[model samples]
Target: MTYALTNMRRVLRELRQERPADVPARLWRYAKPKLDVLGEEVLYRARLMGPLAARYRGPGIALMFHEIQSNVDDELRTGCSAGHLRQVIHAVRAAGRDIVTPDEALRRLGDRQSAPFALLTFDDAYADNRLNALPVLQELDVPMTLFVPTGMITREIDAWWLVLRAALRSRSEIALPPMERTFQCPDLASKTAALRQITAWVGTDQARAESLSETLGPLVSDPASLVARYAMDAKDLTQFAQHPLVTIGAHTKTHRFLSQLSDGEVLAEFTSNKNYLEALLGQPVEVLAYPYGTPGACGEREARLAREAGFKAAFTTRPGHLFPDHLKTPHLLPRIDIGYTPQRRSALFSRLSGFQRAMTTRWGAPVAVLD
Candidate 1:
C-alpha cells in the first residue's frame, strides 16, 4: 500500500516536472482521467452526486471552446453550434453560477471566499468566434478569454488545419508517396479518418505545412489564404481586442506543440508570441493557453517555460475543476474542452459538476513543490 501511494505521488510529480514517464506515470496519465470520468458518471447514476455545493464551490471551471459557429454551407463544422453556446451559458446561469474572465477564475483559486464561477475561454481565435460566438456572448452579457495565435493572425503561420480539412473534403483520395500510404476518402467518415490520420502524422501546424507540401504537392496552397478565409486577422481583432467582453491570451506564435520543442524553442514560442501580441494589441498579454495542451504536447516543462516567460497563467486542455491548490502551479492549470456537446441540460450538467472534474483529471488539482 505504501509502495502504491509513493508511486501515485511520483506520477503527480512527473506531471509537475515533465520528466520522461515510467510505466506507472504513463498508466496514471492515460488511465486515471478515464477512471475519474467514469467515477463521476457512475456516482451521478447512483444519485450520489450533488449540486455545485460547498465541496465544489471555491474554484469552479474553465470551459474551452473552438469555432463556435454554424455555417451549414461551409464545409468545416463548428465545434458546436452557436445556439448550443447560448444554451451552455443559460445552463450555467440556471445553476446559479457566474461566468467570469480568466483573471477572475484564477484569482478564485486563492480566494476561497469568492463566489462560485466558471470561465469561458475560446481557443485558436477562429473568425467565427467573432461572427458567431461574440454576438451570442453579447446577447448573454458575459465575457470570454480568447487565445490567439499571433503568427496565424499576422499571416506568418499557415492555417494548415483549414487547408488540410478543405483538402480532405474536396479530394476523394489522398496519396502520400513518402509514407507510401494512400487514403480513400469516399465519404464523411472516411474523410474524417483520413484527416485525423494525416493530422496525427503531420503533428504541428508548423510541420504540417512542409509535410503536406512535400508529399501532397500544391494540394494545400497558400495557407495564408486559408487563414484569411477561416481565421480572424490582426485587423479584425484590432477593435475586439480592446473590448470589455474579450480577454486576449497568447496561444503561442505558430501553434507548435511546445512539449516537443527544446527549452530554447519553447521559450522562443512563448516570448516571441507574447511580445508580438502585446505590440499588436497594445495590451499586456499576461496569460497563455499552451498550444496542443496535452500531456505529450505540453507538460510541466512547457508550463515552467510559460511562467519564466512572464505569463501570469498558462492553461492545458486537461479535464478538471480549479482548486486553491492551482495557485501553487498557475501555469499548469487545467481546462475542460466543451467540444460538440449537444444542447442538452444533462450533457452540460455532466461536464459542469465537480464530481466529474474530480474524476476526469489524473490529479484533482496541480501540485507544486514548496520553496
Candidate 2:
C-alpha cells in the first residue's frame, strides 16, 4: 500500500512535467498529509517488527547525507540539521549497529561473522559539513566519506541546482525560451515546481542548460556570492581532505549526470575528477558517487567507466543494503538517503535497518548486477 502510493506520486510527478496544466493540482491533492500519514504508519509497523527484521543478517548499509547545517531552517531544504544528524546517529547506534567507514564496510561486506554496521557518507563537500557536521562527528568519533565535485572546489563551476534555487528566490517569474515556458516563482511551492521543471529539462542537455542559466543570471541577485556561501573553495577542500576521519572521494568535475553524455564525455568526467582530487590531496582517490545518481542519471555503463577510470568502487542513489553479491560488483554499490524531517525518524531507521530494502527487493524492484 505504501509502495503503491509512493509510486503513484512518482508517476504523477513525472506526468506533471508534460501536463502541467492539471497534474500539479492532482499531485498536491494526492501528496499532502494523507500520504505522510500512510508513510508514518508503515514506518511504525517496521519499527514494531525491528527484532524480527533484524534476523535477516544482510550486509551493512551505506547511508548518504548531503549537508549538515547549524540551523537547518536557514539551510536549503535538501539538507538535514545538526540535531537531526545526531538523532540519526544515536538511533542507529541504539538499534545495535556500528557506524563504520566505507573501507571497513566494503571489507566486511561478505563476512557473515561481521556484525551489522552502517557507513556514513557525505556528498558535495558543502562548507557546512566542516563547520557543523565535523565537530559533531568528531565528538562522537564517527568516520565518514566526503565526495567532492572538483569543479565546485576549483571555482570552475557552480552546482546548477544551487544556482537555479538562488535565481528563483529573488524573482517572481522566470521565462525560459528553450523550454517554451514561463515559471511562476512567487511562493515556495511555485519555486519548487519551477525547479523541478527546469532541472528535468537541464538534466538532459548540459550545453543548453548552461546557456539557459546564463540567460537567467540577471534575475538572480549576486549569483556568484550565493554559490560561494554554500560551496567549499579549493582551500577549504584541501584543509578538509587532511582530516584523519574524512575519506575524500570523486563526485565528477561539473556534477553533470553521466548517462546523458557520450562514452568519451563519461570517461573524461571520471578521469579528470579523479586526477584533480589526487593532485590536490596528494593521495590516490578510489571511490566515486555518481552525480544525480538516479537510474536515468547513471547505469551499468557509467559504473563500468568508473572502474575503467581506476576507481575501486562506485555508488548510486539506489536504496538497498550492501549484500554479499554486491562485493562481486564493487563498482555498483547501493546507498540509502538519510535526509529526514522531524516526523520521519522512524522511516529513516526502517531504511537503515535494511527492512525497506528487503520489502522492495521482495516486491521485485530491480537490483543492479555486475555485467
Q: Top lDDT: which candidate number? A: 2
Which runs in model 2 stand beyond 4 Å of their true positions?
1-29, 32-57, 193-208, 340-343, 358-362, 365-371
Candidate maximizing TM-score: 2
User: For candidate 2, lDDT tens digit of each residue in 1-371?
Assistant: 55345445555555667665887676676577466567646756655635544643355777888878665433325578888888888987887788987778877876878887888899988898899898989999898899998777876665666767777777787888878887765555556556666877776566766776687776777767765788788889889888898899999988886787899999999999999999988988999999867777888899889999999889998777777788778888888888544336557756766656555555343343421
**Candidate 2 backbone collisions, by pair:** none
- Model 1: lDDT equals 0.73
Candidate 1 structure quality by residue, lDDT tens digits, 1-371: 55335445544543555545565576675587557556656666775655532354335788888887675324534378788788888877876779998878877767878887888999988888888888989988999999998876887775556767777777788887755677766555456546666777766444555667555537766544777777788888877887789999999888876766789998998988999888988999998998778776888788788999999998887766677777888887777777563233444666676554434442344322111
> For candidate 1, what is the TM-score?
0.78
Each candidate's number of clashing pairs is 1, 0
What are the TM-scores, per candidate, against the unseen true structure?
0.78, 0.84
